[model samples]
Target chain A: QQQVKQSPQSLIVQKGGISIINCAYENTAFDYFPWYQQFPGKGPALLIAIRPDVSEKKEGRFTISFNKSAKQFSLHIMDSQPGDSATYFCAAAKSGANSKLTFGKGITLSVRP
Target chain B: DAGITQSPRHKVTETGTPVTLRCHQTENHRYMYWYRQDPGHGLRLIHYSYGVKDTDKGEVSDGYSVSRSKTEDFLLTLESATSSQTSVYFCAISEGTGGHYGYTFGSGTRLTVV
Candidate 1:
């Protein structure tokens, strides 16, 4: 059922602009949400994550905004740069013994200089 | 980059042949996972192990089997490779804490079945 759904298959943004990617999850039990950055021919690496208790978290230029009631989360990249071009993924994992993380379809970001 | 290594980074095989992908981790993490990545689909967990000899199925477990005889190695076997089995496979490990919130992935193995 694709526990997590991501939007904007591809995004093209100019340098100095902001890049935003959104994700929605159907499972309310999911407590931990994380975003991953992946370059072509490489594996996904952890970027930032947020727990349900908080509404937002920021790491450098990357910001994760979560809406507990809406069951959605978003990743915002401030001051986009060409070097930031990569595929971003959002994942959801429920709190407990499962430890299984479910990921959404990725969003490819192209930050033009 | 997370102390994970997948062998046969690129492989070409004939259908009906038996092929196996190996994932090795130096972190000694308790959890190991195998996933497939495609154009539209993100990462689909094929199988995972909580401990040695304790493996379980994931969303896309069909046509694939996994084994964990040791703490740092997980093996994914394709009993009889097929064209549909062609894809990029990744292995990930989850430490109790630190860098990765969920897991850390391997470099990935690109498999092609003809």
Candidate 2:
């Protein structure tokens, strides 16, 4: 049923530009939203995450803006750099012990030098 | 990343053959998971274990079985290889329910079923 849906299977951005990716979920039980960054031949790493209680979270150049009422969230990379080029995945899960996650399809982001 | 390792970074097996992928952790985390990655399908959970001898099936557990005899190791086995099963498998570990603490994934194992 594809619980979480992400848009723009791919993206391209110029250096020093703002890169944005969006995701939406249908499950109201989801309270935690996390984003992962993956590089070729490597495992995914946690980039950033946000909770339904907060509207946004920012770490360095990466930011996650969440809309709990709308069941949507977006990742914005400011001053994008070539090193930021990679595949990004958005995932959601409920709060509790042993709660598994539901992930979106994923987006490949390319930042031009 | 947490201390997670996936053996057989790459493998090739013939149809109907059985394959087992191993995941070992040094972090002593209680939660471990096996996930498969494919084009157009980000990552699908195959199975997960909360503690030794306590395991549960995920969304796509068909044709796959898992066992966790110790908290440090979790194994995923393919009963019979099929071309459709060829995909990159990843092992992840988390300290908690993944609600507060995010997961750390292994490099991955590229499995090819011919």
Candidate 3:
């Protein structure tokens, strides 16, 4: 079973427009939610992360809105740029010493310049 | 760029042959994880090690084995290569347990089995 589910396998947005990607989880034990970005032929890098304690966390132009009760979270990128075009993965994990993260299928985002 | 490196960035091997991939880290992190990435499946953990001489299987570890002799090195071995095992493998390191601080990933190794 896929513990984390992401929507919109692919996305396209014009430069300067906002891009939104959504993900949902079934496990209430998950406490840490993180998003990773991957470029072609490279490893995935941590873009942003949020804990369940906060409803929203923002860093520069990237923001993560999380809903603990709804078991849902979304990533919003303001002023999308061509550089932001890449694959994004949403992951969730319980807080502990040996917890392993469960990742979504991932979404490919393209920004038209 | 957490000083993580994966050797043999690309490899093509024959079926039934044994293959091993290496992950080296200068960061000396406590946790090392091996993950496989396919087209439909984003990333599935095969094995992980929390300390020297300690290892555990992950979500997908049927045809794979791993070893961590030292803190700086983690080795992943395929007992016998299979066509279904053709995928990209990634190695990640975390300073703290459970990766609450996030992980640093190596470039990746693209393994193709014929």
Candidate 4:
């Protein structure tokens, strides 16, 4: 079963515009949520992450808005740029010592200059 | 940054052949994972190792087996290569500071079965 579900298989945004991608999860046991950014011919790198404790977290131009009641999380990019174009993955971690990550299908984001 | 690498970055082999992928970590992280990436399927875990000689299967463990002889190394072996198993494979390490954490992935290995 896919524990996490991400929307917008692909997205397009104008330069300096806001870009948003949403995700939802089914497993309440998962407490850690992280987003990964991947480019062609490279590995997916950690972009940003949020815990259930906080409702929102921001890092530079990237922000993560989380809602525990709805079991959803989203990544928002302020002033999106072409360099930010890539596949974004939202993942949830199964709580415990042997933490396993369950990922979504991924969203390909494109920022047009 | 976590030092993680995968060998045989690219490979091509015939069906029924045996294939093994290696993951090595220099940071000596306590966790290692093997996952395959395919279109529309996201990343499916094949197996993972919590420590040396301790391994467990993941969601997509069929047609694959794993071994962890050392804390820094993990191997995934496919006894009989098939076209269905042709995809990019990635190795990751869970880095934490005594709390919740995320994973650091290697460059990945592209394998093709003819």
* DockQ metric for all predictions: 0.55, 0.86, 0.76, 0.57
- Which residue ranges in model 2 land beyond 4 Å of their true spot? none
User: Model 1's lDDT to the true fold?
Assistant: 0.91
TM-score of candidate 2 against the unseen true structure: 0.98
User: What's the chain B TM-score of candidate 1?
Assistant: 0.94
lDDT of 3 by residue, B1-114 (tens): 559999889999999999999999999789999999999889999999999998999999999999999999999999999999999999999888664878889999999999
DockQ computed for model 4 against the true two-chain complex using alpha carbons: 0.57
Q: Which candidate has the highest DockQ of all? A: 2
**Segments of candidate 3 deviating more than 4 angstroms:** none
- Against the correct fold, how does model 3 do in TM-score? 0.98
Better of 3 and 4 by DockQ: 3
Q: Which tens-of-lDDT digit does each residue in A4-113 have in candidate 2?
A: 99988999999999999999999999999999999999999888988888898999999999998889999999999999999999999998878988889899999999
- For residues A1-113, write the lDDT of model 1, one tens digit per residue: 77899998999999999999999999998888999999999999889999989999999999999999999999999999998999999998876674688899899999998
- Residue pairs in collision within model 1: none
DockQ of 2: 0.86
Which scores higher on TM-score, 3 or 4? 3
Please rank every candidate by DockQ, starting with the best: 2, 3, 4, 1
Candidate 3 has which clashing residue pairs, if any? none
**lDDT tens string, model 1, B1-114?**
859999989999999999999999999898899999988988888998888999999988999999999999999999999999999999999875322357889999999999
Model 4 C-alpha lDDT per residue in residues B1-114, reported as the tens digit of each score: 359999889999999999999999998888899999999998988999888898999999999999999988999999999999999999999765212677899999999999
